[model samples]
Target: MGILTSSKRNRRPSRNSYTVSSRPSSPSGAANGKSFFAHVKTALSWTLGLGLGALLLVGLALGGLHLHRLATTSDFFAIRRIEIRGTTHFNREEVLKAANLQVGVNSLTVNIADVERGLRDNPGVAAVAVKRRLPDAFEIRIRERIPAFWMLKDGVLHYADNRGRTIAPVSVGNFLSLP
Candidate 1:
């Protein structure tokens, strides 16, 4: 009777038929058939958050450096002295006043290139150099425009330099004659 019962149990199920039913399968069957895009959205959010945080940190560092420079340099507010050289036609006071540089003004407030440009704007000045002498000083150096030739155009006196740049025309009596 025991041998007959074991044979009956072994012959119960066939290849095509079983007591348990197979659940219906989906193309995206992982985790109850969710799409792949749902996973990607979560990963991108984390990456973007980290990138924005890093950018903010860099901006703050640059701002701190600029503020420190402003605090340390006295040149940021005033100039203490002015030095002039290589000039004869223009007096020291005339050039300084024209440059709009004031004694005791902030050194940082002045643009040396701009000062040189202002000096050159004077008809008599050929070239100009504006430099910081350190601690509390500015140096203004200039070269005078030399007369190389004289020309009379319709009775107007014009002076030309060696390079043919014409100086301002004035009365013939005051016009410099080149040697």
Candidate 2:
């Protein structure tokens, strides 16, 4: 069915300032009654304003939550344990010392770049990967420095890894036993 239509005598012009007159009183005011486009434009403007405000509020709330998460300490809620693997040139103690990593430090506080720099400082470590094992653990996987060649000086022979750092001393050993 079509829209309900009222008798011409039953409806009165609206008192709203924006509402147009039902009958044109002059030549310039040729248009009569509210134009379909004018009603659509007013409705759209109201909807657009409301929508924009709602979006802005949502954005601000999200930003605040993100800032809070960044500033708060996650370590208090999570525990971290570390395990080292694939190390041969350096002992566990030496590797740990070089890494400068403390057991009690928060995993969230772990800086990847800093850890990498510290681990690389160890002559026996060529490369390292530090990973967070979720709620309670961290894992360090290292590529042990390779024994590239042996150098002899002052009647003593020293073993050098891939980075040419002395790892151990040897007097007389076969070349095959270097690495």
Best by lDDT: 1
Residues forming the 10-long window of minimal summed lDDT in candidate 1:
12-21
Worst 10 contiguous positions by lDDT, candidate 2: 170-179
For residues 86-169, could you state the per-residue lDDT of candidate 1 as single tens digits? 876567778888787888876766778788778778776777888887667888878888777876656787776787776767
lDDT of each: 0.74, 0.71
All candidates: CA RMSD in angstroms?
A: 12.1, 10.5
Model 2 lDDT vs. the true structure? 0.71
Which residue pairs collide in model 1, if any?
75-108, 77-106, 78-105, 78-106, 78-107, 79-105, 79-106
Compute each candidate's TM-score over C-alphas: 0.51, 0.51
lDDT of candidate 1 at residue 9, scale 0 to 100: 77
